[model samples]
Target: MRPLNKGAKRQRVRRDPAPSRLFYRWQRIWLTPLYRRLISLGLPMAALVAGGHVLWSDPDVQAQVTASLVRARESVERRPEFQVQLIRLQDVPDDLATQIRQAANINLPISSFHLDLDEVKARIEEIDAVREVSLFLRAGGVLEVVIDQRIPVVIWRGAKQLEMLDAEGIRVGYLDHRTDRPDLPLLAGQGVGPHIGQALEILDAAHPVADRIRGLVRVGERRWDIVLDRGQRVMLPEDDAVRSVEHAMAMQMTQDVLSRDISVMDMRDARRSILRLSEAALEERRVQQAIAKDVDNNL
Candidate 1:
């Protein structure tokens, strides 16, 4: 083993010290521009080849692309904001869900791209009590739908089948409200629109007014008539029916007219009123009074 003596090493280096920087020894480095360019380009070229090998050589590229596409589709479909919700005047019944789904035509191709609001609204209105529809597109691709329902105010008890009509005389077709509606007045014959509408209006104006209306029947275009709930008929003269109805109402209140078992309240004469009771009804009333008298005499 040789001992390292600072003195010996200093004597060897004292004459001239080696260059402090390694590159300082290469005096001609800047002179070779071609070499510099090649050296600089070498690293990027290797990286480019390596990247190309990774991109093209792998058999899983197609699978990865397909997987990405599937994920994108699933992500869109599963998003909470994209879920569709619907409501009706009544919540849609599960039993009718199939019918509603069919009516919506969701799977139809062109339905997605094109919209016909007027047509859709018109179709929806065709339903028995549907009054309004609201539709909106959700952010994640879902659609929200809502419906408003109409209330029936009159009964169109025609010869064939009974239908529910609104104040405007619009038919609402067979419905579940028949039990409740039966308590309402029944329009026996055809051409009972404005009459029924007028009756409902008057009835709505004040409580018990509607209950007194009984029913309105259309006799030819020449005349109109109203039937009281008490099984009496009131003939209204042709023309100014509104005034006639109002007059009849006032006369009824003044006379306590409806309070009696009056047969009819004829407003046709314009100057006078007529009353007619059915023979059977009069007989029944007479019998009821006789029974009351007999009971009073015994007491």
Candidate 2:
């Protein structure tokens, strides 16, 4: 080899110390606060959720979990504190209490959780005699049922049967005979249920003839006909019906008009009172008229 010049030196290759582009980008994202937190917390949660889903997907596991939960619930519900030993009725007669038990149809020694109080209450209130009802569990494992019985205010004689009704015209119970409730005023004829208030007012005004009055008959569902014991009736108009009754009572008080031999006192016309005489009275009037006519002709 030829001798090299001292001024010409050999050159060496140099390498970069920084990381690659992909590794640099990944490192930057990993250093971020949100990404670091997510990486730390999310991975365990995701793994846990996936494991749970896999385990629950097995039918055997699902059955075991369901059975465990049911057993737990039963244990809690079957405790003495949740047990209903018996049902007690408050403000209910013995007969009605029996009826209530029949209506409730609940077996004894049931869990209070299993006893649907609302459904029991609804069944109890279905009775015609029950105005309202309340149900609750007493401290001594007794299911208490409180009842408000419908009080009968009047006796209604329907076309085919007789029934007792409350003040609101709701049927309370059926009657075997009119003598069953002699205290309540008797109401008859169609559409009388809705007009019970008006009928009651008329009855109140007829207190003077209460003993002689039999019942009130609704005429054509528009007016009232007060029937008396001795085949007598006071026909009242639709408007001012109570006032018409008052007028009849007034006449009875002053003139003893109800005691006369009149079949019907027609107060339908407000201006005048027309009296339909009895058959006997009509015959007597005809005979008298004939005698008077004969005497006048002879004169």
Candidate 3:
């Protein structure tokens, strides 16, 4: 029943946090040494501004820039592909350049052959040509390459595949892409060539057939099936395939037996030749032998 107070007492006002003042104090502390040092040195702010420009504005950079450009130009000229300049590489001594100019000392009608872009690329890859390469104008006034001949790995028939391999069994290429250079032996079925140098050696040493074979395929794991230009398969055995191949090759030349349409001449048999006749040829020969036997009995 006593008089009730209706008005509320005033609330204390909240103060804002003085984070900026504290940060300023820290900033002053941190900067004190640097500012004092500058003041003691009597160094002017304008001097620092001038020194920065002097250190950064280097004229030597221009020389470095020019030298880099010169190296780039020289490198481009060095490549045989770009005809910008004939460099030290162009006049290679005792190389293909020398061989092509002198290789024909053994041959009569030929003195030198000119080299073209395509020929230049191919001849340089050869081992014996000294990788010698030279440029010459071809019949059509096109670029041609001349080089000393390489020792052929073997004679190749171009009708079958794309690459020509060397005697040691190094692959060149097929598709006649580079024709300015001379051709090498044709080889095929190089699927097993993943074994590298050894596989090629096997092909190189593979008897007389190695020389006469037109195409070769790696068969199974350890054998080879060689095809002659006459369209016959000469099956070389696993062991001493080289010598077995020699006997078969001798038979081909001596008996002239490869002239027949044959499917396979298996030299895999150690002692005898296993002949696989073409189906059509086999059928015809069977019929003729039967007729000859019947005629003989009647007589």
Candidate 4:
């Protein structure tokens, strides 16, 4: 091979560097391997979310989506697996259960998905007797309704009719006559329903005089008057009237105070006790006093 001269100009095989494939020049410096993976996943997801938001904003698209969902729901409801063949009720009287069933207004073999359980429960609970109600679909495709009936504690005599109330003072039912539930205690007067708690407490404290109790009479929407079987009444104080009743009961047990010919025993003043003598008793006392005076004068 012939040697080339040292002074000769050498032809350089210059190749062009490949152009950067990255869209943003900064990405080449800032984007790490993990960042590249995140970008690959997040960009498509963000695009899908943005597109969905835009589609949802359109009224026509919204209507179409709603219609599609409704159609899907209807199709699912038509299947036998979703159908309710029967309804069962627990903890309800026969008449009330029948009423609840009627109130449900549901057709047989109805789809559970189509039934609004909440509306059914609300409707059933609207009955004054139903204290609480729960509805659910059983495994056997029966719509089960469980009712908690309010237990009547006392019969309240209103202006027009008598009402049965629970211990919590919730009116549960109506009574044609107060004698229907003679076993239950009777309460009368305005605004007496809500104060059943205090009334019950007072009655309990007056248990010593239960046989003599006619009924409790609410006075001025506050305080109480324990009416005895005879024409006698024990007036109680406004505050802590239960204490007053208990005190009266204790006095009656020891002193037979209620057995005396007293028309009224006013214990309204906690500091002192007062009793009003009956007309007969007052006349007898006056006659005795007059006889004693005559004897002293003669002596």
Candidate 5:
């Protein structure tokens, strides 16, 4: 080996300015918009997932979290604004109001959040007299229940008992006796429930003989016979029963035919009216005819 002079300086080697292959590839990937977004969003989401998994792995921590949620919910639900302290019924009678309260079965000072309005409405509508009902939580902690009660227009005397029915033929309530609802028109016999509208119309047309009307009987499930006082019946046809009744009323008003000793006024034939006399009236009529015949022969 040759020895170098002490004054001579060693030359420095030059390095490349570009990055390595691995580092260059990583830089290109980092510059990509999708990659950058993934890194930005995925890290926090992974961290959150890991943290949640660890937190919920413990039973005590899970219970605490559930309790905290329940308390939060209860805090909002127990607010005074959400509490129901009273129940007010609208458009309901006192007797029915008592029954509706019993049906509601609600505890006072309860949270409105726990009350099921639909369920309460269903309960109240179970009553026979309730036609329709609506329920809502009003201001000032009042639970208002509005009710539409059925109005009874007629009394149906069934084979078993008497039932008060509305105009639609739906039962309002049951009555112990006919005298309980004397204001409403009485109806009897089979298949009258479905034809109550016609019966009502017939009764309306018989207003001239309203005082003598006892009831109406459904004959053969097709026709109606208006039963009047003194065993008198106005037999009406199946169709145009209102007109038939009107004709009978006109006869009663003009000729006082219904006031005679007639047992039945057969208005079944719209063309003509037939009067079936009572037994006594028939006997008297036969005696008069016999006397007339004997007088003619003598002449």
Candidate 6:
């Protein structure tokens, strides 16, 4: 073309577009549906994680945050609306009410949040006579405590002290002496605390002869021995001991056997009954036998 003189400029051919810059690629990706969704969801979570790491890295900051939270909580809890103004006790003796007061150790107009109901109940239950407790906050900001005390049924004398026990064999209180509570029956011996129910049953069965009763003694932690007046004893079998006492009472009514000079009436076998004569009765029997022998020889 006109011999296209050497070094003559030719028409430039258009080149295909080069790949976009990394920034443009990333920008395009950011506008995609998936990238937008990730940014929306992951950005807050990542920021929260980073902030938590920063917070936990400093102990002083963590403590300050905790203290601020606690102060806020306590400020709301100590409001007048949550204050306990009065305390009332139901079915409790003056002594126990005083004990409850002392155990609670709460000041008047104290906040309910400061009073741990469970802790108060446990403290009141520390009294040996307390069987059950019901606690609640009533109208007028009154904290009410209802007590169910254990009733003493028998006096247990052991472990070097005298103690009153309930029907369930729980120790109620320590006593100065047996006569302090004459109304309840007396029980004494080793390992008798757990068997007070059976002992009471035997006593109930022996009511007809109650006047002669000295007390009930536990033998070998298994059986019972009913001591009576005039140095007499009724030995009962370990099992079904109440039946033996009933039988003895019946015999006393009919034969007046307990009034006689007997040392022990053994009913341990249940199938048969044995009697041990006192020294005086045995001596008289010997004398009578000698007299009978001499008379027979003379005949």
On lDDT, the candidate that comes out on top is 5
TM-score of 4: 0.69
TM-score: which candidate is best? 2
In terms of lDDT, model 3 sits at 0.57
lDDT of 1 by residue, 250-278 (tens): 87778766667767767777777676656
lDDT values for all models: 0.63, 0.90, 0.57, 0.87, 0.92, 0.89
Residue pairs clashing in model 4 are none
| Candidates, ranked, lDDT | 5, 2, 6, 4, 1, 3
Give per-residue CA lDDT, model 5, range 1-299, as digits (tens).
77667568856677767898999998898899899777788878999999999999999999999999999999999999999999998767898999999999998999999999989999999998998898878999999988999999889888899999888889999999888878999999888878989999899899988999999999999999999999999999999999999998889889999999999999999999899999999999999999999999999
Query: Candidate 6 lDDT, tens digit per residue, 270-292?
Result: 78899999999999999999999
lDDT (Cα, tens digit) per residue for candidate 4, span 28-85: 6347777676678777899999999999999999999999999998998888898999
Query: Could you tell which candidate, 4 or 5, scores higher by lDDT?
Result: 5
- How well does candidate 5 match the true structure in TM-score terms? 0.76
Instruction: Tally clashes: model 1.
Output: 1
C-alpha positional error of residue 203 in candidate 4 after TM-score superposition, expressed in Å: 1.1
Where in model 4 is the C-alpha error above 4 Å?
Answer: 1-78, 286-299
**How many clashing pairs per prediction, in order?**
1, 0, 14, 0, 0, 0
Per-residue lDDT value at 191 in model 1? 76
Report the lDDT of model 1 for residue 40: 72
Query: Alpha-carbon error at 135 in model 2, in Å?
Result: 2.0
